[model samples]
Target: MTAKFIVIEGLEGAGKSTAIALCQQFLTSQQIEFINVREPGGTPLAESLRDIVKAEHQESVASETELLLMYAARSQLVHNIIRPALAKGKWVLGDRHDLSSQAYQGGGRGIDRTTLQTLSAMVLKGLQPDLTIYLDIDPVIGLARAKGRGTLDRIEQEAVSFFERTRARYLELAESDERIKTVNANQDIAAVHRDITQVLEYFFQGLN
Candidate 1:
């Protein structure tokens, strides 16, 4: 059987990590084989790239630079981690993927879509998630959760307007993509987990 690629995506502090982890746990209980990977930080090279991109010190980084580095990390991660895991017939769960680049760079930074499309082609090599779960949340609540996490990264330091643009772009993409599913993430953690699980169950019903 071909491996199922699932991508969990959302703004920072939207409980994406928690939801992904819960999904993994549920899959394990079902005796499913799976590999969890996070984009821009999966393999060794990609993890290094993640540090550079998320560090608070690089506040002056240009939009183009950020986009390029993200693709670089993605290129490495795909070749090193995701492809092999999938080839082995193990499910792949990604914490975040290309949609994040589209949101953060194209929407937040207002980059040219043509350039992003070209970069994605060169780096992603046609690999796409079978199912993309978007954890939707308000920017204010999301930023509040981020603030509670203590320190903020360069991207996290952006104004509310940036996040608004990011969230809007994410919704736009979700609405256009049949494989994408949006889940409300403003509720408590358990409720968010329940919604995610319900979505996943319905999605996987066909596979089962």
Candidate 2:
């Protein structure tokens, strides 16, 4: 059987990493072969791209630059990690993917959708996630969670209003796409984990 690609997406501090971890645990217990990875940093070169993009500075990285950098890293990730894992019939779990660009660059940075689509098509080589789990949380709450951490990246340093737009866009994407599932992130940690697992299980069960 061919492996499935599952991408977990959300605004900053929406507990995407934790939920991804939980999802992986579920797959492991069920004896499902899987490969877990994240975008913009999966490959060594891509990880370098991540540092260049995330480093705090006031050099004014344009929205297009952000989009391109993400695609550049994504291009490398697909070739080095995603394609091989899928070819081996290992389900691939992605922490974040193209939708983040749609939300962050298109929504937060006010970039045009047409350009994003064009760039994505060019770099992604038509690869798309089979299932995208969008963890939805209010921007205010998400920002607060992000701030609780020790440091902030260039993108994270954006104003709260930027994140507000980003979160709204993420929800918009979820509503418009059948493959995208929205999971409320405002609940207690365990509850959030359970809800995410239920959604994943439902999807995986459908595959079988």
Candidate 3:
């Protein structure tokens, strides 16, 4: 059987870690060999880039610089980790992937879509997630939750408008893509888990 690459995407505090745990549990119940990866930090080199990108810096980080760093990390993870694991028929569960770049850099940071498209094409070379689950939440509530967690990272410290743009872009992408599903994350944890499980169950059922 062919391996499947699944991605979980959401704004900050959208409960992605919990969702990933649930995914791992579900896959384990099915006896599916799988590996979990997080964007910008799956491999050693990528983790280094992730630190550079997220750290509070004295110098202003240009939007293009941020974009390039993201793609650089993604390229490294895709080539050295994701692809090789998939080739060995191990299911790959990603905490975030290209869609984060499209939403954060393209929409939130107001980067040109064409530039993003070019970078994606060049870096990904036609790879895509078999399924993407997007947990949708209002930026206000999401930010509050994120703040409660502790100090915010660089990207997480952006203005509310930035996250609003990112959330809008996420919804737009989910609407356009059949393989992408949106879950209302504003709901309670139990409700969100149920919705996510339903989506995963439906997908796995179709696979059978």
Per-residue accuracy of model 2 over 1-208 as CA lDDT, tens digit each: 5788999999888998898888889888988899888977899999999998898756877777888889899999998999899988999999999999899888999999899999888877889999999999988888789989878788888898998898888888899999999999998998898899889889878888
Q: What is the RMSD of candidate 2?
A: 1.1
**For residues 1-208, what per-residue lDDT tens digits would candidate 1 score against the true structure?**
5788999999988988898888898788877899889977998889999999988662578889999999999999988888899998999989999999999899999998999999998887899999999999999999999999999988899999999999999999999999999999998888988888888889878676
- TM-score of each prediction: 0.96, 0.96, 0.99
Kindly report which residue stretches of model 2 are placed more than 4 angstroms away from their true locations once superposed: none
> Which portions of model 3 show Cα errors greater than 4 Å?
none
- Ranking of models by lDDT: 3, 1, 2
- Window of ten residues with lowest summed lDDT in model 2: 56-65
RMSD, one per candidate, in order:
1.3, 1.1, 0.6
Task: Output the lDDT of residue 81, model 2.
Answer: 95
Clashes of each: 0, 0, 0
Worst 10 residues of 3 by lDDT: 165-174
